[model samples]
Target chain A: MKSLLTQPIFSFFVTIGLFYFFKIIYTKYPFALLNPVMLSVITLILYLKSFQIPYEEYFEGAKVISFFLGPAVVALAVPLHEQMVEIKKRKSPLLISVGVASIIGVLAAAGIAHALGASSEVVASIAPKSVTAPIAMGIAQKINGIPSLTTAIVIATGILGAVLGPGFLRLCGIKDPLAFGFAMGSASHGIGTARALEEGELQGSVAGLAMALNGVATATVTPFLIKLFF
Target chain B: MIESLFFLFCFLILGEFISTLLTLPIPGSVIGMVLLTVALEFNIVKAETVKPSSKILLNNLSLLFIPPGVGLMVYFNIINEYFLPIVISYFVSTFAVLYISGIIVQRLDRS
Candidate 1:
């Protein structure tokens, strides 16, 4: 039993199984709190804890899935490419909105963390919370924060942005899909873009563009912000 | 499909290579994204060639984020201590960014 559990393949299977199980539940219920990533993380942690298995062992296998994140991020260009027509139409406004949102997102997160008495390390981790996990983790490390903590915060931020963004957009009477998707992706990253995809192709494309641009914008600006503020 | 995936991997590798050479703080994958976007825009790479694989990958992009997220368990102690601040910052900041961005972009779109 010990050998079987320790096998790297075992960890791989478990991660995929748990994710799919939670994904099914999320699809059936479709509730904000039933977020698949959140649920899968909880379930996996509990499973390992109950069995007395170490996290390092589990991550050894699970890292295989994580390896794909780079290429997956690169894949965002396809949608951005497909939507070039609309993008070309309003290049200046789109770039301006993404730039403003990126700055505001990082500042707002770090500011809130500082105001709430979080340590500087925690504030740095929160600074990249709006970007996707991979880029957020990289920025967190560069800015002298714990990458693991940044990953958690980034994921939590994504889930929260997805849950709240659309409703708030409606409340603000923002019906344009470009505006809606860009805001969602800017605030939430990949998960928010996933939700945007549900709305339509154009929305999804713009969201993908926003997610990628925000990642670049956040990376470029976060170091300066940390130097000045934190 | 195979060719498209191959192109993506190649671009990813090239992006990593350039990023390391330049010592840029930006992630290579994002650099790869920009590279690919330029390629498509300039007709260096046809959109259809990459579209299928890109769609499959992006659609399941959230799944790839799980391993790092689960790594959170290792930091439970620090997180527990900072729970209130973390939760508050996440909620307040996310809402503020979303609301502000949406409003600004919407107004810009109308203009």
Candidate 2:
């Protein structure tokens, strides 16, 4: 039984199964809090802790799943290309706003983390928190931050953004769906874009654009921004 | 499907090769993404060749993060130690970007 728990198939099936299970719950309930990633992570952590299984043992099997993330990131090219085609109409304003927000996302996140007395690594990890998880993981690893920590923070940021993003933008008197989408996508990434989609088609598409552009934009800025202060 | 995987793997490997040669800090995966985008834009790789794999991967993107995310179990102490700062910075940066970007774009559109 001990060896069975350590078996490669054990971790592989557990990770995939738990993820899909919570994914189903999240799909049925569709609450921002029920985010499949968040739910799945929490449940798996508890199970690991309760069973006395080591992270290394579990990771031996799970790493195979992780290997696919690289190619999956390459797959992002499809949506980025699609959105670029759609964004050609009002390109300047869209690009300018996302560009500014992208810079602010890195600067503000890293700067605030530093000022608040987070250690250097924490600051670096938080620097790319505004982008999608895979990109954030990549940036964090490149910059001497903990990639796993960045992933967790990225998820939390996504949940918070999806929940609070649109209403906050509206409170700031944002009436345009495009503006709303851009703000959500730049600040919160994909999950926030999902929230923007809830508002309308225009908001959804633009938010998708914002999410992709913001990924590229934030990736470019994070290395430079962290070097200045760190 | 196999063709799409082939194209994606080619880009991923090419990205790693370039990043190593240049010693750039950007991850090869991101470099791969950018290169793949350029390839698609210039018709170097037809959209249809990658559409199926891209669709499946993008749709299931969140699943890929689980392995890393669960590693959070090891960072509970860091998260606990810096929880206040993390929470504070997250709220400050997230809303600040949202509000400012919204204002800037709306202003840009109006003008």
Candidates in order have lDDT scores of 0.84, 0.80
Where in model 1 is the C-alpha error above 4 Å?
A: none
The candidates' DockQ values read 0.70, 0.55
**Model 1 lDDT per residue over A1-230, tens place:** 98898689999998888889888998899877777777777788888888888889898989999898888878888888888898788777778887888888888889988999999999999899988777898899999998989887887777777666777888888888888888888899887887787677778778878888888899999999989987
lDDT of 2 by residue, B16-82 (tens): 8987898764567767878998898999998899988877776666677678768778878778989
Our model 2 lands, by Cα RMSD against the true structure, at 3.8
Model 1 docking category: medium
* Chain A fold similarity by TM-score, each prediction: 0.85, 0.71
Show model 2 residue runs off by greater than 4 Å.
Answer: A119-125, A132-155, A158-185, A188-230, B102-107
For model 2 chain A, the run of ten residues with the poorest summed lDDT:
A193-202
TM-scores for every candidate against the unseen true structure: 0.91, 0.80
